[model samples]
Target: MTYLASPSTLFGRLINRTQYADLPWSNILAINFLRGRLNRLSANLPNLIEELSDENLQSAWKVLQPLYYDLYMLRAIQESKQIVQPGETLTREEALRLLHFP
Candidate 1:
C-alpha cells in the first residue's frame, strides 16, 4: 500500500525552495487587479447599502465586515513597510461610517 504525504509537508518543502523574487509576475498582477476591484466595490458600497431591505441590511453588514477588513489589510500591506500602523486598521464603527449605514 502506498501512503500519500501530507499536503502541508509538501507545501512547506516547496516553499522552502522558493524565493519571493522567483514568484510569478502574474500573481502580483492579480493582486493589483483585485485591489482595483475592491476600490470600486468600496466606492459603490454606500449606494448599495441604500437599496437593501432591513433584513438584508444586516446580512449585507455581515458580508461586508470581513470584506472591508480584508481590503483594509491589503491596503495596509501594500502601503506600509511591513509595519502597519494602528490607525490603518478599520474599526466596526468606522466600517459602518464608510458604508454610510449610520
Candidate 2:
C-alpha cells in the first residue's frame, strides 16, 4: 500500500502491471467510448500540428503534450493481451493503476 502512496509510485506501477490487465465488460464499453474520442484526437493531432506556424508552437505544445503521454501509456497497456476468453477481472494494482491515473 505504501508503494502506491504518491503519483510517481503510480507511474511506476503502470509499467509492470499493464500487461494482461483485465477489465469488466461494462468498463470495456466505457473504455471504448473514450477510445473513439482519443482516436479522433490522435488522428487530428498531426494535421493540427502541421497547420501551426513556428510562432504558434507554444499553443500547440499544450495539446500535444497530453496527447503524446496518453498515447505512450495506452500503447503500454495494449501491449498486454486484450479480452481474455475466461474474462478475468482486473487485479488490485492494475485496477487502481488504470482508473487512478490520467
Off by over 4 Å in 2: 1-24, 62-102
Residues 1-102 of candidate 1 have per-residue lDDT tens digits of: 111323233233222213556768777566556666665676676687778898988876787778667866765666685687778778998898989965
Q: Where is the poorest 10-residue window by lDDT in model 2?
A: 1-10
lDDT of 2 by residue, 1-102 (tens): 011123332233222224435756666566556656655666566687678788788766676678667866765666554645444667889889998894
Q: In candidate 1, residue 86 scores what lDDT?
A: 75
For candidate 1, the per-residue lDDT at 49 reads: 70
How does model 2 score by TM-score?
Answer: 0.33
- 102: Cα error in model 1, Å: 41
